[model samples]
Target: MARIRVLTALKIKRNLKPGMYADGLGLYLKVRPGNSKSWIFRYRTGGKLRDMGLGPFHTVSLAEAREKAEVCRVMRLKGLDPLNERLKEQQAKTIEAIETITFEKCAEGYIAAHKAGWKNGKHADQWTATLQTYVYPVFKDKPVAAIDDTLVLKVLQPIWRDKTETASRLRGRIERILDWARVMKYRAGENPARWKGHLDHLLPKRSKVAAIVHHPALPIDETPGFFQILRQEATVVARAFEFCILNATRTNEAMGMRWDEYDEQAQLWTVPGVRMKAGRDHRVPLAQRSQRILAQMQEIRTGQFVFPGGVQERPLSSMAFLMLLRRLERKDITAHGFRSTFRDWAAERTDFSNEVVEMALAHTISNKVEAAYRRGDLFDKRRQLAEAWAAFCAGTAPSKP
Candidate 1:
């Protein structure tokens, strides 16, 4: 009941045509247009066909190709698309010759590999600064494979108590680098930087770390006063901030809003999954004030962004909204905390259920069991909630002290 293996080294050598199907999922050892022999591994992921180029046949042997196909098959079984993780195969080839791969090298490679996906250079800059300042001093040149949990804790322990947020992000970055190294065949075994089961036992819970006060939400009653103040200013930054408050969108989401994403007829703003924090395309129901802000931005729109900055082809600076808040004399509250403010208003002032409010905020449900049972199809209700919140903020006067 087993299919005979017909495509061997001799067969590949003789019949190097452009269309030679070999192994599982349409794995083909074929010649490209110019007779450059290549192997392409095709597999189905999420009901879609994906072709993964294995390598040139001249360099890749039959046994090696089979080995890679097996790895992809295993990944597919675990619900991971090997196409996304193509670096694994590419790195494995060059990595075996590298005996002493350093953590710094891996860290740099990780940043280089992923920095393109980040919205701006600030994220890469932060990664570089943290690694150079905190991690490099400890074990930057050390062989990444030899890095143990003890080493990870050593880097984190000094700042864990004093600089909780930085330390937390540092630990996660270390973990990701180690993971990347492992996948690239530079290291092996359990990830020492992982926090869930391993490092959680080593360090105090993040929630218990009280040194850094995270985004402090403005009081629900004070939001209207703040919104009115923001509206008084005629600057584009102020208009962007007003739009943010009215829609309850994140700072990046608000700043990164594209002209093409807004549909006037539908009164909808379709935020591509790449731009969203939840990593899913979100359909935001634009309120009257939000629509008005869009219309205002259209009058002075430059490039693709709804809120373009001084720099060409760039949105507003990452700190633009923060600086706006500081000018408004509200440095105590963050732009991000507006989501919490909106949640508070929804729960206390209105009869809207928590689910609708959460949908409006684009908060992905964490509980798998709860998520599986509940269908997140509360768009119409969220529209009503958005309109109500807009009316309360724009129409009503600030609450009397």
Candidate 2:
């Protein structure tokens, strides 16, 4: 019989020659010039013979190499190309590894890749915040490839109606991330967060599901007393809060107000279209008290924002007014509800036109016909109404402060 398994483990380890040594059954040891030893199976397929490397000698011992060589021998005997079979095995493993990528990893990748293109810097932060608050708690660690409609619904159903806008945004964001995963070959199939055809059937339309929520407003008759109490505090937030109520602006608009947006000469604060909810520039006519508050802020103006937060160079927190309410033992009310109170007062207490009052609140006119016809913001009339509002809050006749 021809020599088979002739090279012992000790001889294989000790031999440092740069040549191939046959060990029967087409299995041979390849010793490179650098003293690296590996196992190879010389086989004939079609008309030519070729060498296929099994593995390195250090990791695959003499016995292991023989076993792999025997398998390749059997494959060739069965008329299969061993090299092609190994390539297929490798590709399958690579796809399996890619499939193991997690949803959190994909989300982070998506945010990092697209945040630069977003106009607002806070957009990235909001994406991360919402994912952390909602999605991560549910299935962030699960494989991205495994995510489906059932898992997606679990994340949105609880907050769907309670936080309609946020839930809607989150669904869209998840859809985008899943799409990204598909493009990267991490996942495949229809996106579970897709709304129109897939999720629409499972869930109600956002508008139909979301009930219009009215913030708890203070009684119109008691605003003057509440204003008097708010005036007693000398904090920067208190002054900013007072300015907000005087203007009848939204919480975000007031809290994000910058000194640069104000024009002292005209007694007007022009909120840029970027800051306005309607995406149009809004001119707010500052009243006498509001002007006084501006003067006070100008004295201590440390940063760009009119209402500087505790942190340097940052605006006040959204919760500042709510916290202020808690401190004054008025937890029954909300800062946003003050806008409703202003609306009620304008209707019941003042003779101001609906157009002027709505303009003061910077509310988007839902009536398309009326909005089209109304051109001017009625700044002069709004100024008079603002002064009247201040007087009512002060429990004094409307006067120039």
Candidate 3:
């Protein structure tokens, strides 16, 4: 037997004090704080309680709310989920609005929304470039809703193996655009460009398709010889490259170093959070050789930057180190590969702890538990390590502690 309806139209009109008023058969008229009112349908499904919203009391009358509740009750009796069914009906209505937006329009909208927050300016250009080059030719004019798995496969399949890296990046961009489309109600259903569980079955893994290639690095023993040649060059780029190798800093860090970042008395160069790859401030201890470079840099320093380009105010171009390498006729090795050279030298020849070496390179600690306990930066220990690295590059023995 069903319970009698506890709430009437008159009762709902009079009582408005922030509480649930039952209408029986899983229908409820709830009053919220500040005298707001709404209808809810509560039911148990698969041993879990679920509450689905009906229309608000001001819009839906008692009889109308009861009618919606009855439909939901009937759905449960037939072993279907009414809440999920309601969503499907709502989604169908949303698709009616989505059909007008095309894939290209949606992709442009997504890029526009995200461009400001992206770190690199080239990233914004790449988003439009990749889509224009590959994806736009196929689906540019088509409605986002019309992009199915088959259509997406048609766009990706030809380049999947031959241009594996580009194809992988394209697939990710397509998936992100499709996801944004779904959220904006310009599309519906599962993302057709999704890789895991969907496209994984269709295409081979990117690793299997693309050959692995590492950046060329100088052999550990060969660094001192290279350093000797590097020291002889009078160019700012040469000095920057030598600073990069000594501190195990990236090219950007070396080139972007400014006058304010250095503490002359403390002998530390602090890379601010904004400039660092991990978005954390990294303190690089100045070795005797690095300090000597800084002293020479100060004598000729034109503007704010330690390594000025042709213009005094601006830092060196990002390609400066690579061009320097090319000029030296050592085109086989990249500027970034110097970090690996530092790591190799540390592992093979030094007695310093691995943490100190990694810290010198400003690599993020991967072990969470170990990192948590390491509250101190071990700057003194790292100073010793940096000094040793400098001595090694100078073709001298590290002084015994």
What clash pairs does model 1 have?
A: none
lDDT of 3 by residue, 58-155 (tens): 89998999999999999999999988998899898776667968999999999999998775667889999999999989989999989999889988
Q: Which tens-of-lDDT digit does each residue in 252-318 have in candidate 2?
A: 7888999889999998999887777787888999888999999999999998999999999999998
Name the TM-score of candidate 3.
0.72
Cα lDDT computed for each candidate against the true fold = 0.84, 0.90, 0.89
The best candidate by TM-score is: 3
Candidate No. with top lDDT: 2
Tens-place lDDT digits, model 1, residues 134-250? 999989899998899878888999999888889999999999999999998888899999998999999998778854565799988777777777889999899888888888999
Q: What are the C-alpha RMSDs, in order, of all predicted structures?
A: 13.9, 7.1, 9.0
* Distance from true location, Cα of 256 in model 1, Å: 1.4
The Cα RMSD in angstroms, rounded to one decimal, for candidate 3 relative to the true structure is: 9.0
| Number of residue pairs clashing in candidate 1, backbone atoms closer than 3 angstroms, sequence gap of 3 or more or interchain | 0
